[model samples]
Target: MDEQLMLVENLDMCFSTGKGNITALHNLSFDVKKGEFLAIVGPSGCGKSTLINILAGILRPTGGKVVLDGEEVREISPKMGMVFQKYAAFPWMTVRQNISYGPRIARKPKSEIEKITNHYSSMVGLEAYEHLYPKELSGGMSKRVDIARAYANQPEVLLMDEPFGALDDITKKQMQTELLNIWGQENKTVIFITHDLEEAIFLADRILVLRRPKEDQNSLNFIQPVPFSRPREPELRTCGEFVRLKAELSEVMLK
Candidate 1:
């Protein structure tokens, strides 16, 4: 597989508050290829979102660099679609309207917008709900809408910051399975952040583990080549290899 994206060399992040200077990320580095699912896991405030924010161009790093398709990340665009922990769907808009927003903002023609919206709504299994408003949707329905809108824009990279974090366990699992199905069809490069070990193991082609320091420092422990096969089977979670990998990550994360 060719490398479509990478964070080459050392990457750093810092912030200055009223008290003093703070460094959120230190020497962060990783590489991802096309159609790969990469998951980043760490303790809360260990700079998971900080790293993501930097990648999204929402927050520029204080030092180092990021290389996307051999270029620096200068701005955010539909080329990268972000899904947050909360369903950031517009409650006032119908599902179709919400999905059409991105294409419209890009000044796409009405004919093109309709084509993409209908395609994405069906892709996310939300075709029947396109006319429904957010208030009429269930927890699962709302999340599907958010996902539909994100993918409709035809992003090359999908950045999900614990999208299932707000869902019930059962619903979360169902969404995970649904996501894999959608991904199989779309094949976009994915970077997903999750605190759940099982979630990382289940979804990632490889996992990047972030470390938190007792004295308030940040570091990384890279463990690649994780054997998470595509089209995952529910029974795989019970397999010894799967449990062992999950256990190994737990041991490192605890300190």
Candidate 2:
């Protein structure tokens, strides 16, 4: 088994709203292995987005802490990268500029920034569109820019919150394939947030399910493992085993 890369222990989050204190997560704990692709799924109001934000260090939990590679994540760190559901590219910047933004902010050498830009733009098949601004690109192309930018940052882990949730079905499928190809080549640990069970099963090594908190109930539903082999193709979606797993997860999701 891969060594553990992140530890979430006894996490708890509460909000002070106009109504009063409301808990979002309660005593949630899990471990993500190094280079593992872990998908998180749950219905609306289940705190999937909140968990992603906590992992990205964008929010501080009311209790517990996230330990990444042995150190606690107290605030936003350079070691983590995120891709949001909407296209996160800057409208004013061209593809090359957007991809190089992180390295530039870090004050990397000009040559290194240029190299990083070229490599990631090419990786996302955006070399031809490198000079185009986000406004001129298609939705899928814009998303490619977002992915390339996040990867070029060279973060230890990638936290994606429904990055493909806004694309049309066809484009979403294409991006999913491209994402898998990138993951295969890079071997970076990923924590993906999605409501789609099919998408979760298709891309993740393991699925962590959460439930809406009610009263004193915990937020965790269960964690399911994906046993499929790698280099998986779209045809796998039609196979008996894949369909069975999807059905099982659907049952769990609807409960």
Candidate 3:
């Protein structure tokens, strides 16, 4: 079997509010296999975002480690790329420029930058939009740019935080199909964090659940596995197997 691409072990994340320190995740652990599509879901304030941040090395964990490949990284590794919940595209830059921003910042060879940006623009279906600015684009269009920018870096591990949160239902579903196409084409390890169970079920090979921080009582701890088949169809949602799996996961989510 292929090796795991990322591993989060005994994770503990806490935030310091004016009130005091609030523990967000307690002893959370999981592994993401290479080329696998993983999703993390939980109630609000369950530290799911924090966990993603830690894995991206954007935020430091109070305890535990995010090991990629065979080693732990002290800073954000260049091999990891991210798409935030909100669109993080640069309004001043054209679509191509935004997608090429990372390579530009790294001072890559001009020839290489052009080659990569052109390829990514076509890959994300934004070739025509390359010359356009973000403000000229729709909300969904901005996200497409964001995804293109991240993938243009050719990162082996991708971290997406509710990338479809802002789109309308129709646009959101379209984006999902687009993302699956991209994932299928690249076959990289992907970790998607979201609250939408249906979305998770459709896209994830495995699902991780982070228990809510319960001040009133101790939090539940565990990651749930999703055994649905790939190239999931709409009818899968109505199938007896899918129905029972979703109902079970929903029970855990409501807890």
Candidate 4:
């Protein structure tokens, strides 16, 4: 079977500012393999969020194209799901209602929707809170609802933009493990955006490093493959290989 699932070619994004055009991304190109966990890390203002938005079809790029599943993407597709840094749960919807919103929109069978809601709620540890509204949930619990909602949609590729960035250190760590567990079970291709090098190394099969483009030069973006074996434990973060990889990524980020 072919490993590659998505192709990004010569991607570029430029904005019209008062001072003139501001280029957020230039000639960025890469491929995401089927079921691969790909993390994107970069310096601030390096187009990390912009890139994810374009991939999600939330924004249009000035140049280049994204091809997924052998077709060019020009607009939003049900095949792509997104989980943002901020909690995206509907304020008025109960946990069960929120998680099942996507499938319900697609007019899935009532039985299937119920099953999906139950499955992802349990997967994200929200089964106990399924009947509660967003106002009654903690930030962590709300974020769990966001994730479950995304997975419930059953997208071929999941796009995450710093989903745990606002959580406390303990909660962030817990979410990371939970995300990995969900990924293992779902076997979906994931494109995760984060500023945390350790988080990227911990969760990604390969890490893509992006640099801001200069007026006269094209910033070279590169990908680094993570070497750790699957089912990695939290203790792996303290190991020598993990440290070395993190150090290497840090240098890449700075350069």
Candidate 1 residue lDDT tens string, 149-239: 8888878788999999989999998999899888888888889999999998988888888875334444576755676666797778889
**lDDT score, candidate 1, position 61:** 81
What tens digits encode model 2's per-residue C-alpha lDDT throughout 8-31? 998899999999988888888999
- Cand. 3 TM to true fold: 0.91
Give the Å error, residue 116, model 2.
1.4
Per-residue alpha-carbon lDDT of model 4 for 63-106, expressed as tens digits? 99999999888888879998988889999999999999999999
TM-score per candidate, in order?
A: 0.93, 0.97, 0.91, 0.96
Better of 1 and 4 by TM-score: 4
| 91: Cα error in model 4, Å | 0.9
Model 1 TM-score (2 dp):
0.93
Cα misplacement distance, residue 31 of candidate 4 (Å): 0.5
lDDT of 3 at 105: 83
Query: Better model by TM-score, 1 or 2?
Result: 2
lDDT of 3 at 162: 96
* Candidate 4 stretches greater than 4 Å from native: 215-220
Cα RMSD to native, each candidate?
Answer: 1.9, 1.1, 2.3, 1.3
How accurate locally is residue 93 in candidate 2, as Cα lDDT from 0 to 100? 94
Better of 2 and 3 by TM-score: 2
lDDT of 4: 0.91
Score each candidate by Cα lDDT: 0.84, 0.92, 0.83, 0.91
Worst 10 residues of 4 by lDDT: 214-223
